[model samples]
Target: MPSATHPSPPDKSRAGPEHDLTAAFPTMDLETPSAIPTSGQCLDHLKLLEAFHVLREDVATTDGLYGIHDRFVDDVYPSKGLDEKEAQLLFRLREKRWAIFVANAERRYTIWFQNLPSDRGRMPGQLALAEMSGYFEKTSGIAFDSGINPPLDILMVWHAHLLNPHDFLEDCIRYDKKLL
Candidate 1:
């Protein structure tokens, strides 16, 4: 059979899988975002996730969730600090007195997230198991979804605060407390 395709010179470029675009990019490695499963410890994070979820529903009702999409799974409820947009969001969250809120919020959230089971392998994680077994919301198995995103968001916010803990802590100073 006559080969219609022009063959490249050996000196010019290598042939076979090495030269083929498909072969050259056979497998693409991508960073998969995991759900940050947790047994709720930070009330603010829980509330915020619910707000974000509600925001999603509202926005979708207005339009149709076109640009925005949910995180990987329920485990990692809120995928935080994974991008520039999110950084901007956190930046907004820490505006003026709000920084104090995020400072305290993130500190508590990060502490809780860090304390979560480090491993999520064959066995279900501590948070997930607790949820399924109705340990969290014991009211007829109506547990709060301790999403991955919220804590992930906390991780980002907390780390940002950690970058300058003293400054943030100082910023968190309430003059009312000193008056007492």
Candidate 2:
């Protein structure tokens, strides 16, 4: 695996203009609930804690969001001719084998980082998109068509702190719920 400062190897199958990834973005349905958090409805720390306390008392399963993803993913939303920065992110995903949020027109998948060590104490680990061959697709909650490969549009890059005002979260990256 490459270091965070480096990019991954050259591979057309990973991501590029040849991929034609325009049809991979899936929209979220507001009526149903999912384990993943969506967009447009995030709260600050105080509101999060208050909501958590309230939900703790009730049996209502409040599947909310910690934070939203940044705009980098949006820049490459079409996933055509992925630039250096975009390719670098994909290389990180490939190297780390992080369970990223891959989307097609129909569904989303959570590709997990199977090689990560479990003994990180209280610190959270990163999920990266490195190589396409290493994707753990079965755990991602979607069944893809034979020739279909989605774009790695959103990644919920987790952090280990909860000190944000807009998001009562350790951290969030590429966490747009609308793109789920």
Number of the top TM-score candidate: 1
Cα-lDDT of candidate 1: 0.37
- Model 1 spans > 4 angstroms off: 1-95, 120-144, 151-155, 158-180
Model 1, 5-123: lDDT tens per residue?
31111132333554342332223322344375333324444544544444333332231123222332222435533454443332332232233434555654544444343333322
Q: Number of clashing residue pairs in every model?
A: 14, 17
Highest lDDT scorer: 1
TM-score, candidate number 2: 0.17
All candidates' lDDT scores?
0.37, 0.33
lDDT of 2 by residue, 1-180 (tens): 334344334332434554323322243244667676555223232333443333222211111211223233345555555566665665443422222221221132333222122233221235433332234355443333322233232121211122353463211332322111
- Clash count for candidate 2 is 17
Query: How big is the positional error of residue 102 in model 1, measured in Å on the Cα after superposition?
Result: 2.1
